[model samples]
Target: MSELAVPGIAYGGDYNPEQWPEEVWAEDVRLMREAGVTMVSVNIFAWALLEPREGEYDFSRLDRILALLHENGIAADLATPTAAPPAWFFRAHPDALPVDRDGRGLSYGSRQTFCPSSPAYREAALRITGELAARYADHPAVVMWHIHNEYGCHNAECYCEASAEAFRGWLREKYADDLEALNRAWGTTFWSQWYYDWDEIIPPRATGAVPNPAHQLDWRRFCSDELLSLYKAEREVLRAAAPSVPATTNFMVMYNFDALDYWRWAPELDIVSNDHYLQSTDPESEIDIALSGDLVRSLAGGRPWLLMEHSTGAVNWQPVNRAKTAGELRRNALAHVARGADGIAYFQWRAAKAGAEQWHSAMLPHAGTDSQIWRDVVQLGADLRALAEVRGSTGTAKVAIVWDWNAWWSVELPSQPSGEVRFQDLVRAWYEPLWRAGVAVDFVRPDADLSAYRVVLAPSLYLVDDEGAANLAGFAERGGTLAVGFHSGAVDENCHVRLGGYPGAFREALGVRSDELFPLLPGEPVGLSEGGTASVWSERVRLDGAEAVTSFASGPLTGVPAVTRHTHGTGTTWYVATLPAPSTLADLLDRIRTEAGVTPVRVTPEGVEAVLRRGEDADYLFLINHGDRSAEVEVPAGAADLLAGKPVEGGTVTVRAGDVVVVREPR
Candidate 1:
């Protein structure tokens, strides 16, 4: 992949000069230079300002803004600003507004209020995008083109008349206009819901009882593709107009925003970028940064990607906006780079004085240059400059986790066996163990090539198709260590139960057969014979050809197999029937990883993260200490501490509490 057109790591944040007075533009640029800023996204939500009236366009303010940025030597990531249509658009076409699941009509004013499938919205969006492209195609300030704001944030799925028609069209193409095939795929015979005509099928909307699971799943897929089509339409227009500049939209790929299937969306994007914010509720929110960055980089196929938006301190949306501590901001930024980001950016350059996100933190906060936030921003800019060589470097992972949006969507549908089958929780539970074990792992598509990985983990994978199952079995057969978690392989692509037994797909490979699942209560954890407790889940399993490594010590099905191991074609498969305690799970995972001959990038003490990114000349090692005490980090002989600008005296660099150090070791 071609990197962003910048000398080093791309810096700066979203610049919304239109929100401020023209007189302030000079001061903003002066401060940007002070912070060593390089690039910024402009006009992200400026549709109303750019297109004031129907078919009327204004580029005067944007032109001046670009000229000022160019004079200051700051690159621009010009946005099309199609995410928010003007109020006049809603007035002209009220049907463009998205409808809630309850069939309630939504009003304008909020961002992303327009439905994705609306023809009027798409046409108007593409027109503005084309105009912007034609104007700034050759502008010296422009380096990249940002297509839209975050997709599917406010209106993930709409239940309007137009959306229903669009959904019908999408389904027709999917089933090749075969009504019987559609019925068989949807399994609509249970409630006499067979569709004789194409028009009879509508989105699964506002039903009294739980709607057909298959219909709901297809609706989710259709909604995602609908927005993707919109993005592609806009991308085509931009491609023809600004053929050189790369185009991308901000993706919210965290556990909180799991609407789009990024595996499908990654191919459409010229640059894989995302907007990530620390969840206020989680005490250990830094892990979210690592997870989100790895996910983005995997979507980029191990190429470096961009951190489109993050907050300097507190974000305005959470229930309680807690500000970052003194050194927390810098640690957060560098962690993203350690995972795979080549660029670091924020939500806004200067804090807004008015509007919805007035209180959101920024590079230039409302306190101006006299505050700690401003000082930290300046220091971070220098830190990035010092470690610029890490850009375009690729990180390697020996372990891969299977994650699919279809499985996530299907596993959480209503009327499940247990309420604790949360998709995000499952991923985090399995991922945190690997994180603490200091090994790098990549999240792969369900049907992706798994031969490169030494270890593969599928946790709570409740839904899978034949090809995906075969891929997993083939990986195990090729001498890879495979770990299967509870509730996996229960259903196929059509959401129909893989009958005969639970975990139907992998039963042959795992050598275990289970007919019933004993879902434990929230607080009623069952005891394991291996001196630990397993919570939330416990399955009754009988060994077919596998060996029972452990059993349930106390539960409904006492003495039942709790964990089993089977050898299938020279490789081993371990099936865990319950969510074990973290320590036990970590110990088990480490044992299996060691058996498979997979080692960490560099083993370090607790709270100190070690990740290696290999470049053309050298391998860069990022050591981040999340603890309070100082940490002595050992590097290879002749390694230099890039941050300290000195060679290691005794192959050791003492990283202070709440600090980051990057070591450069020759390959």
Candidate 2:
């Protein structure tokens, strides 16, 4: 944020000139220039090349790559090449192989194959990183140091002695030699899982034992800590050498690895970055992308994050590999900026000649710059550079949505009464409506400050750590409008039901308690909105201190409290007991919007999503046409679309499908 140095929105992605011969390097540079790529990430997976055998070093190729990027006037997003130890090194030190969850030693066939706790792996990684940092720390072209690639896998850590010792140390720090407390916390009494001693706690093995969710979850947490330690080690070395350059490790968005606790690790990085690849095709797609981007932005306290990796076109890994339409890319890119993105970079710059990613799309397909994808990339780069002045643009959201990863992890660990009640689906059903209407929203942890937000929405908030619950109580008591949805406040952090009532600690705030819940099947109509019956998952509610705002129309508990509102100290809490249809949700949001005095960014004619971002000096409103048909939007009197350089004052703004029009409004 300090404006001492650095340009806005540097562009480019992983470049592997080492994979191709020198002849292709010229074409790569030419095409990169054509596409306006101002940055290049180099040496991402070159550990073997850097250190051929033991105690030997080679930088000839890396030197050429750096020189090439600089020669082409592109900044370097340099990598330490520690992601994978080379095949030769692995062959030399077979003990460096990672151990699977089931206790089998893995062969080095894929990347992400090194055990985090392995001393051999650590020492070698440090040597490589130290060398790379020492050499490139002073390079003028280097802008940032990318620590590593995605740092997660289900088969993390190992039963090998190294990992076991590390796990013991982790437990010692957390439990302080109280193994009994650990057993109790894990609910080990059910299957006689109580451990007599800490050593008795073994890593989950596929062949020898039945799965234990608690132990599995704890293992995941420990593995994450181990990887964090690894990243910190590299980060420290890089920092000591080049303290001014930013450093980061790419994060998997909405990832469930490690009890979903990204908030814990986000602060360690200089800037937040994530890979976004969702498999949904709806008007809400942009919203989904925005929510994830908002989550990252919120993690940084409204600072911008980088879109480190996204598919340029269809990825071969998905169940359905659908190429994005011409305008889909631009819309999605702007969506990132709309939420708070400083940069947009794809998974790869060039499609692989032969590999798992061969079929994956790229900015330049196999045909290079002649491809249509390259044309899109060129245009996107131009637009972004032109708009770079707004790199740190901030958006003000009157509404705050509370998302608790602990609750998500704890709820899924238990075999729920039915699989129909999923954590993610419930959240989407509740959040989609507010998002579609172009409401500026923040995704914060339950413990985040709520005094700044006018409206607070908590969806499927099953986990309530004591401090988090207290924060919620304070927020509601201090005059904030709270919305509580289905399966919320049902249990404490330990997954134990609150002794006093069904709604648990939030009962006083919500002013309601229920003895039973009704789960409806798909296609089954459980209630009605304003005009017709609404289908899908619905819950029956009983009111205590709250009054019914709406009721089920035809269920057994018909005309009962489907939705209730309770008055707190200076605010009101609305409890929605079921998953309502989209229209019904929009209606509820409309009410909240009115009560909170939260205005939509704009009032468009039709088929346009209105977005507004406010920076230190300027505020820009975006009119996005997400539909197939052209949309005619009516802007405020003296506004002009910055992207189009056109003014719309006579109440008419036209936009084509997937078109994004940025309107700069005078403050």
Candidate 3:
């Protein structure tokens, strides 16, 4: 399939002309032209307006919107508006409404209220999609097909009768109608939960006790598959009507509650796109923005990706709704571009007059074009145009962090070693140090090829399938550096214990065996022999063939290996028995970097991120200062700063706080 066919970096964002009067649209286009907006996503939430009544459709308003955008020289990222079905359809077929885990029906006031398994919802969604695709296929404005927005966001799982029947049918196909296989996989004999037939199984709801681990795991997989089925249904119609137009749906990566497996969904998209909202509560929101962008690029298999939606200022959803500081918005958008996002856009073009997200920020805020937010938006658009040659370039990384949705599901299952052992926390714990070190890292699945990376980090990977285990082992045997953090490789894909010891499949590769897990209490920490502290979790490790690099100084597991290293073939494996302090992890990574012969792109003070994006003819180094104070950074000699339009002679360059500088060098 062709990639999203757009020249340069496609800018602009979701434009809901339906929400405003017809007179307001020309003004929107005029503002878009002034802001260097190249594209606008339209009709995302217009289902109710497009078809106000059942079997009745209206395109007059939509046609005008598309024509206006085209006449203003802006491409259209056309949406199907199927995310929120018309209220009439829900009223006609009440079964299409989803049910909560407590067996209560969800009302139709919010979007994504339809059940994925409901045949009525699927049919209606497809019909609307087909109509939109057929009408807009030949339109000059349509550049890409934006499928239903953020699938599996609100309605990830449903316990209604329709979903229950679909779940049984899915199980039958998965188990080949064999109840014995399902029983064995779920280990039902222990709980007397053995099923006699497919109909006996139901959606894993609030059982008296914790649901079966295997059952919950399968339910998660089933829910993800059901949503994928719905996306494919819409995508098929779009493809049939508009074969040349690339189709994509925005993904909310690591949003915690989203269960749609992006690794499974990435293959179905022509171009990968992601919607990232900063965690205003966390000070490390910049790190998260870069992390999500890198993951999306990796999901695109190193191809360029789109930053589909972010915010220009304060988002209404967060508790505090903090607005962006002076230059933070520009820095945030450049961070995505530096990491490999070809296009940058936001959640809206204009702030809404009346809606749930009325207070949300936009290119044109409530204060209009004179506001600082609008000024920053226009500057970002001009900057994108200035660096247009960077489009289609890719970031180079010698480090990879393994990310698996199945493992994320398994580690967070109830009855774990510690409630504090969250998947994202563990990942961020390991990711923070590398990110601080200015090391460009790519996120890869356990099964991804490891030959290109010198270092691979797998943190809190509780479930490691046999194939993934073999892949990791082979990566180590082939002379790559491997780091396995706490509680990794403990269970199989079925959530069954690996039986021999803790960190079951990785014991041989890591050359260590864990006998017991000791979760630390809050504010409690154990000292490491290497000087820093380890907290949150610790394990009693018995070194088999590995050397203890860091030993626990004082704790119940004192004298055990807090960190160990083993040499296999030409490679080395490091096993972290606890969550080390950031300084400790940084020191450990420095050592690993030395052993792997991986050099940093450039070293700078804290809050300054350095990354290099290599194109066919030029290499661009992005230096972003995320601090509150200005900092000086070292640059390579004879490189020209693209943003400043000047040459730097391999000396120190002062970068203001929350500012970005791109240095272009000959490849």
Candidate 4:
């Protein structure tokens, strides 16, 4: 499959020409040319304007917008405009609106208020998509189809009657209409929750007590499937009408509000794309950005993916809305490129004159083209053009981190072992060290192929089915080093304990079994045998064949194994019994990396990132310095810095803070 339809890195972003007058479009195009903008995502939220009433369609504004974009030599990532249904449609079909867990119907005015299972909403959405595809399928400016805006951003789950009925139907198909099987899987017999018929099965609603864990799990699965079904319906229409244009929907990969399982959704997309906004509040937001990019690239199966949306400056939604510092914007853009993004797009072209996002930053800020944001945009555009040869290049990684959304949901469900045990935090605890060590890492699903990786890190997995457990064991048995962190392999898919032991399915592979879990109180930490302390959670592990690498020096779990390593077949399995401090975690990973013989792409001092991207004939090393002082980075001999146009025959390159250097070497 083709990576991107455009020539260079796709630039520009969400453009809403329908929001402004016609005269402003000419100036918009002029500014786009001045800024070297190559593409724009248009008509994302124009449903109200596109269809004022049922069966009524208008394309006059859209036609002019596309024509203007083509005239300015800008490609269009055309949107289906189904994210926000028209107010009139919702008024006519109130059943389409979503209801919260309290059973209160959500009103229009905000985007993504329609329930995924509403038949009326589905019909209207598909009808408009057909109209859109029929009109612009062959347009010269349209390069790709941007299906509905971020799916399930607001109302991922609905407790309304329509959704309840749909949920029952989905369950019937999944269980083959066998209530006995459903009862056994859900363990409904535990609390008199057994069902005699499908109709008796409703979505876990707002009960004072905790809902059935199995029901909640299935409800999440069903909701994700429903959203995927909607995307498929529109994708089929676009495929029939405009088979040439690839279709994609923007994914919020690392966002807190994500509902759809992106692993399942990635297969439905013709091109993998994601929308990532920086968290200004977190000092480590850059790390999150890199993580998200790696995940999306992995979702594309090591192919170049598109960065569908990022902010040019401060996002209006955050509490503080802090603007990007002087060189931060440029660094942020290049970080995505270093990971494997063929496109760097933003949330908007022009700042909204009036809306919820009126204060949001755009390529052309409200200050016009005279602002710093516009200058940065133009500079990034030029940089991307100069590095056009980097397009379609891929990054290689020998390290894989297992990330599963089901595991995330299961670990965070109510009544777990520890309320403070966050899945993302645990994963990041392992990822940050690898990132700092200049190691290229891929985020893989639990069932992903493990042969390609020499080392795999699974942190706080908490939920693993039989197939997933076997996959891990196979990886270890086949000469791959595996690291399993605390709380993994505890439960089956239905949130039921595996019944044999803690770390249930993986007990044999890990060669360690836990008898009890001890969660520490805040500010309390147990000393590790290696001279550091472990906190948050600790397990009393008894080793079968594994040798203890680190043991708890004090506390209730004193002298127990805090970290252990066992050899199985030709590989080694390492288990972490508690969350170690940052320094200790890095030390542990460094030892594992060395033992696995996994080489870093480039080793540099702290605060500097080195990533290698390989093309057909050339390899590019991207060196980014995130620290305040200059750092010396060792580069390949006879390499030429692409940005500076200088040869680095000295074998070391000095990079200043907040700057990026791309070293080009002949493959």
Candidate 5:
């Protein structure tokens, strides 16, 4: 907690020395050194090697790996190899096998296949983690404790008696032993699914009651809690043995594994880390990554986070995996650092030869360290190590965007007019303009204090759970302009739709009632004029106390409110009825900036994305060229691009594609 101290941008990744021979291990060490890898994450998937049978363990291979890493002047992030249960353990306790939607117990082959709520699995996992923690907790080479990897990918719940009983207990605690209350919360009246007893409720599966959303929603919440309990148990063991070592697991971003609520998990983590992978070639890719980075940072409350698992090149599992361009990896890495990352680590180090991810990118590809990919890795490492301090140093951002998981969960869980409403899309729309404007931003959930910002943007915001609507109202009442978008506040925390009307709980604050929703079909446009279109879901609303700021035209909702505004205590709440094109969003941002008395942090000459990260007396200005052509950016005539150690003259600094120019302005 004392300012997370890693030597530098901790590099190196899931290293499995046990996977190869001694000679190959030696070669890997040499290659890692060349790649500027100072930190090695070892023993990620070595459970099979560590313990081949029940009540039996071996630590020699891991000892050698840790020792070799230390001997080479590299740090080791020791993993408690519980990611994959040993075949012996799974064989010994067949109950450890996961139960699928069809009630079939899963066979052990892939990793992340153990049920979190299974007592047998928990006992075995605890024993292994406890043993490992006790054995290596004090080793000088060990820097952090990594619990199970990607903790919640397995199917949720087991129809086995153990899980059924556990679910009953959970139900009793949550609903006070009242079946009626439980039935009401789950809205069990639908489909004649009313529960007579706690035993009547079963884990919702894809096969049965597919249309029963309430039951499915509860299942999601239950799954999230179950996995969280698993993580807590592992952390408990690690904390007892290695109290000083920060413990965490890598979180997959926007993942459907409902059990891992990052917001709830963030505080428990010594350092919040996330894995993000995308296959898009669009300009919005950077914006998406930036939003995710900010989300992690906000979870850490502005503390630096770790880019736990990014690929060096193409990912193998995506439907259409594309290799990163020459400079794309570097650009993405720096983008995270610029936002607020303390470290960067990839999913793998050595290439797998016979697994599902065999073709996934690695630090040492199948071609070895002599390949072009290896050269890129080495160059990137050299650059990071060269500018180590600046890369790790914290940056301050004035503007913030709120990201809430509860709202996301409860909002989309409900059956709305159109199943096409995506909360992630709305969030992206609000964030892209701020990113393009070079506005330094942080992501806060609705409950987070909004007193610091001149403008707060909450897009989609469908549920407004966790005091979000009130906070937005408070921010506006306190003279802060808030821009909220479609489906803002329609449900409560219980997944119950707000009683009054759509935007139910927030209608009074926003001064509008959503009367009708119009779904835009493919190839159809909700005209914003000037050739811009909102081509997804459109809404028709009438303003009560709010004034119509923008209107839809040439569509079913034409002349209705596309955007509306209401005067709150001292500021305003603007509601956008549909997802607008970037130009319209930018225009809205311009209006907000003017009304909120805010200005662009700094303007670049052209072709560069300029961002300012302010510290007390030192302001870090990042001028990155995301465009194909070289960009000339204006700086204070004599201010230096600190990372390059070159001074700017006549306020001009030119940067090439994927190039980053870091300028430090001293007060």
Candidate 6:
């Protein structure tokens, strides 16, 4: 934002000057400026270097780094370095070490080994935060306050005795100190387990049998809240010291993370940011980038968010690290900007010569400036400078998808109907069709307001509260199209099954009820009456007031409804009783969207990704080609290609393979 003093899209990555010699510091700055870098994250994981011993401070190294950055015209995304504490603190306060579910206390060797519930850890972290704020709040190169590194990457929860005590305290507050209320919420009567006293409860630690679903659910909620409290505490100290500086922590809101409830966490930050790394082995990984970017944009309430971290080439963590092809790097980076990234950054500027991530790709690779990664880095820098006017552009869409952390946790808990029912996979199944059709969509909590949406899909919403059900029903009642994913509406907020039938909470609105679920084994494909195969799941459905659009053809539930449509009020709702083949589902989604009257300004063909970001004066159109063949996009009238700095010829342009075309059109 303008408040952060970044003139355009901020570039650069994590800079660990402490990791290298003094001779390398100057060279890094020179390389940074040469790459058109404006900002770099500094001091992350430097706690050991900053405060070598407890109560002893040494700012000499960080002082030189910041001074060097300022001299080179590079602003600093200054991190507080609380994510990793020094070895001396860990040795002195071993009680702060986190314990796993089976009760093995983690030793201090890697980063983020400290528990969030440890008071000793909290006090020490805040003390360092306050000291950093008091000293460098007014520094010339400081632009934004990066409060901590990825918060829940390593130690999101701890099952130690202190954490158990903290859990009890959190429960007391949640239930207002009423032990009986806690029992009702946790549904402890099934196992003859009733909590007469607060001390009897603990995080659902290792047990011989299945643990309580509601207990596990609450533990997840508490863990997320505990970490949020730590961030808030540090943020308050930072604000008290320097209120003008915006504060944020990078959220790993992609595949490797499902720890924090970002719905509750997004509003706490001055600006929302996220770290998105492509899963190396996923052939359709670009779709994941779109999903991640849309989610971060939604988390920021449709405002442009920072692309906090990504890899320039192969990342070190995957099974087999594969290098990006010739045009793959810019495709990944610019794709984020197309969705709603105001700034783009990578994880590290220079690949390390030593450490766990020495093989991780960076802007300046180990092979030096002669490598392709460096050449691509130089080209991307020039490209970013050319598209500087695209800042402050915001993305909006009428379609919304429900993404809930609580439901995801409970749906994947032990003792469910099927272990193959993945929440993330189901969501992608629903979203990929829309993404391929070039329809922009935002993610919302189930209970969030849906008045702005014309269509909403809740995929595998196995656990929903009454409030969320009412909200979804109300959206359909008010003339919004709704798609109820298979296996959804079966359970309430407390993990209690809604007993009327399957798809219980939505039975009335959907006007259909399933008698039973038939979860298929791998390679088992049940035929649908609509000339396609349904796999992974199938259900015996009975229509109440709905029309059967398709029926099961080969299962024991043959002649039963496979899919149904019901008209509720002025709106319509569709119930999917099984996971349909990709082509069949895409066709169904297109039909629903057409009936809902949801249309883009122009249709994007099969291989192109079309997105619009509206600024005060113009609407920027991004057409990215992810297919083998070239994609032809009809350029909007009076539009200019921002990338090439020229007008479109013949009112159209062909996007070559893996290339991004940004067109600027007046609003």
Give TM per candidate: 0.99, 0.93, 0.98, 0.98, 0.94, 0.98
Off by over 4 Å in 1: none
Against the reference, the lDDT scores of all candidates come to 0.90, 0.77, 0.89, 0.89, 0.75, 0.90
Candidate with more favorable, higher lDDT: 2 or 4: 4
lDDT assessment of candidate 2 = 0.77
lDDT of 4 by residue, 1-667 (tens): 5556789777888999888889999999998888878988999999999998899999999999999899889999999999999999988999899999988888999899899999999999999999998888899999999999999888789999999999999999999989899999999988799899888989988998999888999999999999999999999999999888899999998657558888899988999998999887789788998888898999988999888999999999878999999888899999999999999899889999999999999998999878899899998888887778788899889999998989998888898878888988898899998999988899889888888899999987899999999998899999999999988999999898987667787899999988888988878899998889999888889998899999999889899999999998789999998999999999999999888988889878889888889899889999888999999987767888777767887888888998988888876
Model 4, CA-based lDDT: 0.89
- Residue by residue across 459-522, what tens digits does model 1's lDDT show? 8789999999989988898888899999999999989999989778999999999989889888
lDDT of 2 by residue, 1-667 (tens): 3221247776777788887889888888898888878876788878878898877999998888888888888888888887777888788778778787557788886687877788888888888899989999998888888897877643356667678878878887888778887877677897778889777777665634445666666676787788888889999999999999989878877423333367777888888887787574443567677678778888777788888888778877767788888788888888787778888888788888886678888887887767778888988888777767677788788888887666776566646544566666667676777777777888888888787899988877876777887788788789888988777787665566667655677878888887776767667777653444554445556677899888888877677777788898898888887767778788887897678788777766456777778977668777778888887776557777677656766766778877988776767
Score candidate 4 by TM-score against the native.
0.98
RMSD of each: 0.9, 2.6, 1.2, 1.1, 2.4, 1.2
Off by over 4 Å in 5: 2-5, 154-161, 176-178, 207-211, 254-259, 280-284, 529-531, 605-607
41 in model 3: Cα distance from truth in Å?
Answer: 0.3
Candidate 1 residue-wise lDDT at 553: 91
Candidate 2 positional error at 468, Å: 0.3
Give candidate 1's root-mean-square deviation (CA, Å).
0.9
Question: What lDDT would candidate 3 get against the real structure?
Answer: 0.89
- The regions of model 4 sitting more than 4 angstroms off are 645-649
- Residue-pair clashes, model 2: 1
lDDT tens digits by residue: candidate 3, 1-667: 3566677877989999888889998899998999999998999999998888887999999999999888989999999898999779988999899998999999898899999999999989998898898889999999999999999889999999999999988888998988899999999997799998788899998779888999999999999999999888899999998888999999998446548778999999988999988877887788888788888889999888998999998899878999988898899899989989888999899999998999999989999988999989999989998888888888889999999999998888898878888888888878887888888899999999888999999987889899998899889999999999888899998999998887799999999998888889988999988798989988889998999999999889879889999998789999998888888888898888778988878888888899889999889889999888898887766778788777876576888888898888876
For candidate 2, list the clashing residue pairs, or say none.
Answer: 633-653
Question: lDDT: which is higher, 3 or 6?
Answer: 6
Between 4 and 5, whose lDDT is larger?
4
